[model samples]
Target: MVWGLRLFPRAGGVDELALDRALSAVDGPVRAAFALQLLEGLDESGVRELLAEAAVADPVGAMRRAARLGRPDRAGAQAMLRSGEFDPCTVQTRPSDLLRRRHRVRAAAVAAALCVVAGGLAVAVEQGARGGGEERSPAGVFAPVLDPAELMRTAAERWADTSRVDFTAWPARGGRTDDDGLLGRALRAWAEPSESVRVSTTPGTASVPPAEPPQLLFADEVDGAAVVLFHDSADRVVRYAEPLSGAGGAAIDFARTDDADVTTGAAVVVSRTADGARFLLAPWIAESTTRDLLAPDTPGRPLEVGPDGVTAEVPRPGAGGACETWPVLQLRSSERIVEKHAFLLTDLGELAPTHLTYMPKPGRGTPARQPREATGPDALVAWARTACSLRTLAGSGVRSVNNWAFAEQKLPEGGASADWVCTRADTWRGPGRVLVQFLAPAASPADPATVIADRDDTALCSKFGQHVLAGTHWRADSGRWYVLGAGSRAVTGIRATGEVRGAAGGPTLAVRAPRDADVELTASLREGGTLTAVH
Candidate 1:
């Protein structure tokens, strides 16, 4: 497996025949990851040499070959990649500052799904595109829990409607149980959730935020006319600036202009429903820009509408370097309304009135830690006696599916920054789930930012989990969070001790709940107090 090659040396211990079989069923990162085992024999010094050469290699194929064999040749490196064995369409940049940045596990996967299907496939056509972006875990936050009872559910007949088919080819979908994954594995450590009825939890009533009226955010158009609207059931929209767009009902027409970018200077219109649905209306971008719909449309039309009203796209996205959340306006042709979605426009470059972008952040930029040759985890050594959840398993199942990427980052006592490369994820298993792996970096004077790559010395999640198994070592807090898995079909958390860390360096709270109970833990090395929870 690519992972085996990255961790252990190619000296032995891997089953080449098994990997070859795996290659047939999977592609993208998983494939490339498994291919890593072949390169493991090299020492730290040898691996470093290969990365250097691979960096400046001329032919892409050469890189693939070397990366595959661990010799690190550019041609070989690209070859392994070209095999469609990995995420071919992954947005690529030098693996420079990757170690320093914190990853947004779920966000990266979502964005990758979009980029891969579009970007990767395009490359395949020419060379053909093969595959796919941020993750944010703001500090001083509480863990989130899923209250299935709260999820709206209809009769059993409604559940049956989930499929267009009457029977499934494989097993039934159920709870998660995979230790390699952050959440999948954690489920085993917690308790079971409860089966309850639906009752919307208002922030005030649930002890989340104070109560208020749910607010409308945006709406999107479907096909041509149907509009989909989004709202904050607890009126949390204004607090987070969740974008709202669909405003669907628009009949925009072109005036036989040669170019598509022209727009009229006509005034824009917006409306909202009492139930928290919003609408945005405006004359075509061409009309708003040139003040003449009849003008040439070659260059591009300006976004005559934005957040603050529509002065050349108001609400001004955001400050530089930070992620700028924007609305993805899916139009029908040059100016027709289709539907819309939220995205982060990395930069406010020259995007057309209808074009979209995503959030950006400030920084000189850090690179991801380039995963070196490694052996597959010990789990791959043995297969599960029975595949528990079809939902949790992929076409190839866990071991054969996602070939793990490994690296180590040491946040020493004094603390130094290190870079870690994170590719956007193409798929996310659990809903609203964020899997975190506590890395045990080898002792080094170099701050995290300077740690470019992982030496074979780093350990696996289970191996290094001891650091956190007792509890988070750094200063932190606790709150109501949830865990989902089958061992018990529930997840329970507790008020363990927390430490000091983050921008404020204060005691933070943490929480985990399995439908039946809530576990809250808060600790501050500085300001200490025992947390008490009543069953």
Candidate 2:
């Protein structure tokens, strides 16, 4: 199926290959009529009229004869008819007009080919399009296609016209889908003239040179945010770059390198916040392969430093030398301090690395705090409760009884009791200092949840590595408490009755009970911690 179009097979007839060959043998006008009837959804009268105007007699009959000769079966014929290459609207002119248009298209194609030939004659061309080389067209004598310079210029014009832009390192590998929410904010800031916005381009910084000739790069800056886009001669986006926010820093200097280097790679994002400069070195490997490298106790000690402002280095963890060790830099001073840093091994390849750094405005600085370890059951429970509360606020519910909340609550020991129960438990941790888990009903299950929050609130959860819950609701049967919700990060707040407040300045949670209801709140604290009831 091409572009979601499928053709049916004929019974005991020639295969698609034979049908294609036969179709190629037909006259151009007859083929055009067939395409119009099949692909463009044109009526028989329309096809006949167009063919008559072109002085082609028995146009419908001729198409039928061609189909029969090709033996394409109904399906194969349909595939040929539906091919996007032919458009019936363009064929509505007189026969002479049609011929002239075709000639013009072919001439344009030939001119492009001649330009490529001229470029080739001047110097040795690389395997792929690079260094002033012309890109050869696979389709000969067809239509005009944009060169790399034209594509870049068009993209830059488009970028300047829009307030928002998204950049991804590996667009073809689904990296484009991972929106970090910074692009929107940057766009908004750019709309205001008072805001600091810069637009420029960097040469030879992309991880992978364009696979096609005429690679182009465009860069834009909004305040402290920076965005870079890489395009090929065909105007296709090959890579994107943007700075990310990091803890203890004004902005994170980071870039996604193409897999052309090593299979496993490391990334260091340096971001500046109001507090100070923050650096985060994370492994760009896959989650399953990051167990050892991202372990909580894994040592991230600096390997080396130099006079060129380079501070530390972490070797790739895998056995192969197919990976490059990334350096994690730390900046420390007496008054201002760097907050936290981490590194992990990840699975990613393709796209070259482009480095970027955004320094916070000199006078705009806030006091920095030392990073603290959030260990113990209290901390775990706090994290779990915050996660659950966010889930509840967002309207998400429990999916299965085999979740962390159920195990932590010891609900299985109750022998399938029908009592309403709520549990919050820890789940997993990301490469950085972020932890993830779930909270839900210990008995009655509900549908997947959704969160309703404004953009800024939603961004909070994303920056902190928290997946918000949505569709969460509180229901009570007898004196038992039951909460239902789903998993997501779009949750903003809960619209429920009661005074909801954040615990330890975390996510806001609230629960209301009837006057006579016996309410109990407890936590399993670890060493040097205490569980207290807030009455």
Candidate 3:
């Protein structure tokens, strides 16, 4: 005689099938309450009063429904009610027969209260009903609440403890059971106490900067290994990094653990493959308990590659032993190409390393590419002459080159690492002066030359600069130039006066140019790579 089922004497007359069907039709909470009342041997009045407290409307009708369906065994009902471990408040709600009749409103309030009191049991029942019991958590148990600091500290200790033990004789590969057995044995060995391993805990308020509030720092700097854990306010190990160290003069390999979990944290282990190339070992932790606490293991998944390079899924433990997935970026490189490092771009735009190993296949043997020649002030001046030819300045009667000045400046794109050459040229037409200035990459030749130019009516004392009225600015890339300033006047024509040459100390065009003439210039780099112009 199971709970919720009626027990019958072995006389074949009872229609147990029909009775079971009727009992199954009742709501879980209602059925549970009814079972409890039957088991408790409540009288008619007591039953009715219990129903009202449970917010079950029409107590008589509910009982009649159950009776018409089947006779539930008192002992079985009592066992079922006890197995569920319902809270006292849930089993006995507020005493009010009047409220039971108006169950629509009262039941709603009672259901809310039951949800709070019953904890996971109520949730399991509701989910079980909806999902045919497939979605229910374990009966009579609530989700685990984790302490982040304790979890990290425990993890750090486990890591330190395991590294010192020697597992050199373990079999490398075997069947599933054998593999699991080997891993378990190895982990046990690692967990053994060792004199070489050391553990230290620091208060959150110590001089060390805190990563977040309510944190605890743990460091396991063993003889041959080191680990640092930063437990955040939520008690989750938010950050874990391996410190660089020297052992036997070998380069130190660093690894990072994924989000901390009770059972095991994902770690990227750096080790060399048999072929002498570096490879990363990302081991999935097996499910185990520590000090009677459950540490669930995470399932292994295929590693993914994205634009940011290799990505490993790190499990972030949430409240109640649940975990969220966080993808961490890793570095990638080819034997022929330079290794490129990647950083974890956090929400605040800060970059941190995922600290995983990457080994790309070696490329075919080929000669290394030569670096480009450095573009200097002379190269920029030469570019300017070709850009500002007499034909390009035709209408203004600009016959000769003028004063030139060059300076090294910073460009917008490359920051301080790359240099830009700023060149300025001064020309004049009698009472008017025209100034041309341009910025070009100083480390490499601008594929196509560009210039920023302005004109001023010297007679009116106007200064020709970047902000001149209708000043023209153009960008040249790959031997083509186009106006960048929309309102500026276009170059009407351009023709090269001579071979492009750098101007060191040249005659001022302002002293040699004709008066009352406006310059109209057009310029373009020709197909042969020479600067051509028409004016």
Candidate of highest lDDT: 2
- Superposed Cα deviation of residue 249, candidate 3 (Å): 13
lDDT of every model, 2 decimals: 0.24, 0.30, 0.28
Best-performing candidate as measured by TM-score: 2
Q: What TM-score does model 2 achieve against the real structure?
A: 0.23
TM-score of 3: 0.16
Model 3 alpha-carbon drift over 4 Å, by segment: 1-225, 231-481, 486-535
* Residue-wise C-alpha lDDT for candidate 2, range 271-321, written one tens digit per residue: 233322222222122111121211223333433332212213222222221
Candidate 1 residues lying further than 4 Å off, grouped into runs, are 1-18, 21-40, 56-342, 345-535
lDDT of 1: 0.24
lDDT of 3 by residue, 1-535 (tens): 4433343433212344443444554544446446646567666677767777777645654553333222336554344444423323333223335544577678788999988889878667777778854532221123112212122222322322343211111111112212222222222222231343222111121122223332223232222333322333332222222324543221211111223221112222222122211112112222111110011122223344222111333222121111122222222222122233221110101111112111111123432222111122333233323332221221221212232322222322233321122222222223343433434444423232333433333321122321111112223333333221111111122332222211111110011112222333223221212221110
Q: For model 3, state the Cα shift of residue 235 in Å.
A: 12
Relative to the true structure, candidate 1 has a C-alpha RMSD (angstroms) of 28.0
Question: Where is model 2 poorest over a 10-residue stretch in terms of lDDT?
Answer: 394-403
| lDDT tens per residue, model 1, 213-272 | 222212222222322111223312111111124342222111110122211111211222
Better of 1 and 2 by TM-score: 2
**What C-alpha lDDT, on a 0 to 100 scale, does residue 39 get in candidate 2?**
66
